[model samples]
Target: MAVTRRQMLAGSGAAIVLSGAVDRLFAGTAEAAQAGGRSGYGPLVPDPAGVLDLPRGFRYTILSREGEPLRSGEGPVPSHFDGMAAFRSDGGRVRLVRNHENRVTAKYRVPAIERVTYDPQGLGGCTALEVTSGGRVLSERVAIAGTAVNCAGGPTPWGAWLTCEETEDRAGTNGYTRDHGFIFEVDPRGRRTDPEPLTAMGRFQHEAIAVDPRTGTVYETEDAFDKPFGLFYRFLPKRPRGGFGTLQAGGRLEALRVPGVPDLSAIQEPGTVFEHVEWVKVPDPLAAQTPVRLQDFGKGGITHAQKLEGCYWGGDRVYFVSSFARSRDGSAADHFGQVWSYEPSRRRLTLHVVFGPDTDVQAPGDSPDNICLAPQGGLMLCEDGDGAQHVFGVTRRGTVYPMARNRQNIGTDQAPAWGEFAGVTFSPDGRTMFVNVYEPGTTFAITGPW
Candidate 1:
């Protein structure tokens, strides 16, 4: 593909320029989008693109897929699985709340659950699956209501799931329910609210969410396209009390702008963050009702700054991965296609690790879609890209390893390729891990060691 820097900028109104030889290599029209730009990061060392390549001891098993029948007896549900969360309700069994980012028109059937309902046009719909540590499905149910393109969201302290919609267009409009472009909470027990969009969470194209247990502060990301692109936001609960209801009280919304970066507003740089750090509060929270401009960093470009997709809270910091817009050339190129850590306690954010091989600056840096920390003190990343996709692991010291290959490569044409692996998490005991493929629309379990 001839993905040139100029064409990339012109095609998308997002103005920001990428630097380095990597930019020149992708300086054509066709190749720019496919190559997540360039950074020092390269592909995995053993490069397990077509096969499931993990460390010495790890194995993956398919738990569910687009047309697979679950124990619930419901017809084979369609695919489009995105983010997921794992909870241990029984001693040996765990409950997984998985998001299905599908529009109403291209909707998938949920497993048997007479009580559950969804907008014909895919508004909001997530599934609750019961699985064993050995990777067997015990049962599956549809949870959440009236939301579409349920992207990625964070798990709550009280054991609830926050599901996000990646589109501003509502259901019925574009064949999707007008339900929301907001955040909704789902209880594992299958209880749901009246389908409320935590307006406090800001609107735009909602992506992943993370919370500060210390302050009950909720941080969110905007996944919009076009002029505004998107911005990261935080919702401070009205009361000190934190729970699903806390979101209704509303709080604050802030966008990121670093002081050191130059103004690349008109260039369309894919992924870049400003050098200096500063947070600006959105003056009007309701402004999200309509598409609005959040920030104009002038020239620096959006980098560690927030292409904001997935997020999880652990240790003393908040870890988030930018889905796209990583710089391949210039000073900021080193940060493209990487994982970043933000210290909530210290109020500082730093690049925790980089993906890919060393020496070559033009290879693929991982497009980590969604992420979760393992009970073993490590991280699991759902890598999304043009080539074969897979699940990967990142150690505290910054070592990257493979966990599983998305098996959606099998079967008929509509089975879908593992284009974007979003949701990922391990059982609380660290025994079983779950992954979702947003494109092929499936979820699976990974058991064993790495």
Candidate 2:
């Protein structure tokens, strides 16, 4: 909640020089914090750009890009595309459900995911695609109809797409409906216009979702705009072991609060940085309509993370990354980079990885957005920034490597880059990879060696 002078300048889109200052701030700081051992390995390449770069033989190709036409006759998809998931329908065909984070000027073109084409009438876009092993689009359709600004989402075990809207407007402005902040369930194989919004998921500025199949609990994160002090949430379905199909049955949504940092209102002030943060749980998430004040959930002395972005569930824990927790305020807390792992079994969360704010592993804006576990167990991250945006990989030993860049140049893509490299996931067999790009509005099939 605290904002600094530099943040003020950046917020106002003013010009300033903090690169040198930021560089000095990171130098020698890694070893100082290490004490005895290394934190993790740095990025694999000095700088990987435009094309996909893997270990010797791995390669990638664009399956679909924003604005591309669908086989079902839909005109094209829109911008602000975020997260996605990969699935198999026919013999070797893969299906993908992708999100779009559109705003005022942005609007959905037509239905394409479920293969039905219809005029979007200014609505934002979310699509599903059927592609081949070689990255060829066989069919594409809109999964959820009549929704806009669709952000990051998670795939349900029952084969449904949980599409989330990132706006809070009860009645959306810019011609979008008021249903902007809700979650919707779309049949990945149905017609684009067939489903209804799944209001069970608490409406807010939802950023991403991760599902715990063991408990049937849906973990979600909200993106707060001004000096982000958002909350993480968990939705328990009404049915004891329900999921996907039961979303409409309704359930309970709980907000994540850091244990200490007693006062969030204090961080609301300008030029101040939140410190001594811990995690606390808030009973209700929808209570505060405007800039919801989330409880701190961390205990002991831990750096507070502001904007909670990309998340993935693997092994016994759920991993999440914080983009831009540092750099804004001079406070050396959750800056640099961080990866937090939550162990549902023991109900404990631990810090997994921390990178220097200005280090090569971390993106310049701290916008290391979407994440996915690689076949070998490391993590693959999409850097969310302009020109410099590229896909980076993190090994189990914590080695970072730039895999590819968005040279296709979709207009208005999110940095660390949004849209194209935005959402990435491997198939069950780990032989095929699917990526969703927002701007040029496309989804691609990436296949090669491992």
Candidate 3:
């Protein structure tokens, strides 16, 4: 059965507060649109290109594609483009740094340079591309290479990309010369750079990170799917103002702890809130044989969530995603997905949105992955769930609306080849939104009323 947003909220025991707010927000919008005979961008229109379907007055342009030659002539653009960010450059141009989530054994990879690569055999890294305000690609080239599983990462306040590896494979294991899981900083301008891993940051299956611009604290999420679920972590740099260099110098790694609440999975209902949460220092940030989450669990240091993914900092709160959680792996119960908001000032974590178990991907509560704060307000979530993938717009009041849909067709096959939509971001000026299709890898620049 398809689980509607209203149904999920009704079932939530303590989520009535959030549910009331959400109902009022949606009611106002729906009522206003009914009076005018149109609501929320006026529904998605089918695209003639058979790629992306957007609403009226919205169009998309293909900027850079996988398997194509790089502008530097080193090699073809790698596949599996994941997390990405855009920075404003001189002359109204935008520089985008994107992660390529390839593996060492993958067929395609960004070429490894002398000092720009950590491991020559490592097959995952990042690339930099320049685009104009008019949505034209100027150049695309390898920015960093020789890393493993370059998944989703956050942009630094100082204008650099923090590319994270989503694996914990050791150096000597699997023909890799260096460690697999760590964060590397990449300069978006293609200037002199060093592709060294920040060992101070713990080694684990890192999914994404969000940096607090005020204190320079880094909040990280893990994407572990095992008996012991992943944890939410924070890294406090020694010299917070020095940016990435301060992180390399070493800092304190800690996990989140909700005082009396040992198991976070118990609060699965939408609008469940936990106040006065604290951070417990991690005993070892660079654990080898034992994972950090397991070690922290032993000491009863923090709570755990299943498949924690995309995270972003917005409106003085850290918003993150727990792709899904189930009791099978020691979780409290089963849920399709969840969105959490951590307010540093209030020292509390609130369950902002909860998705019930439903197979309908077009519904309000599908599994969400890479997320970015919208220029106007709320968030832009990239759907990584079953069925056709879509880009969903989530309002601050918890109303969800489809922004775009993937309609890529396989060769000679009329049936839709549903690929995950990732790396959803917007231009600094908010004029253009960028997103990627995981399979056959394509990056797009979308323009609309938003």
Best candidate, TM-score? 3
Off by over 4 Å in 2: 1-56, 112-122, 191-195, 262-291, 294-304, 327-334, 358-366, 409-420
Measured with C-alpha atoms, the lDDT of residue 280 in candidate 3 is 88
Q: Can you tell me which runs of candidate 1 are displaced by over 4 Å?
A: 1-56, 73-75, 104-120, 176-179, 192-194, 225-227, 260-277, 294-306, 326-335, 353-365, 410-418
Kindly provide the TM-score of model 2 when superposed on the true structure, using C-alpha atoms.
0.74
Model 1 error, position 367 (Å): 1.2
* Per-candidate local distance difference test: 0.58, 0.55, 0.77
lDDT, candidate 2, 17-36, per-residue tens: 22211111111112222211
Error of 2 at 1 (Å): 33
> What's the TM-score of every candidate structure?
0.75, 0.74, 0.89
Q: What lDDT score is found at residue 271 in candidate 3?
A: 63
For every model shown, the clashing-pair count is 56, 66, 0
lDDT tens readout by residue for model 1, 74-134: 5565567788888887868899898877665554544424454445445446778888767
Candidate 3 residue runs with Cα over 4 Å from true position: 1-39, 296-299, 358-362, 410-416
Better of 1 and 3 by TM-score: 3
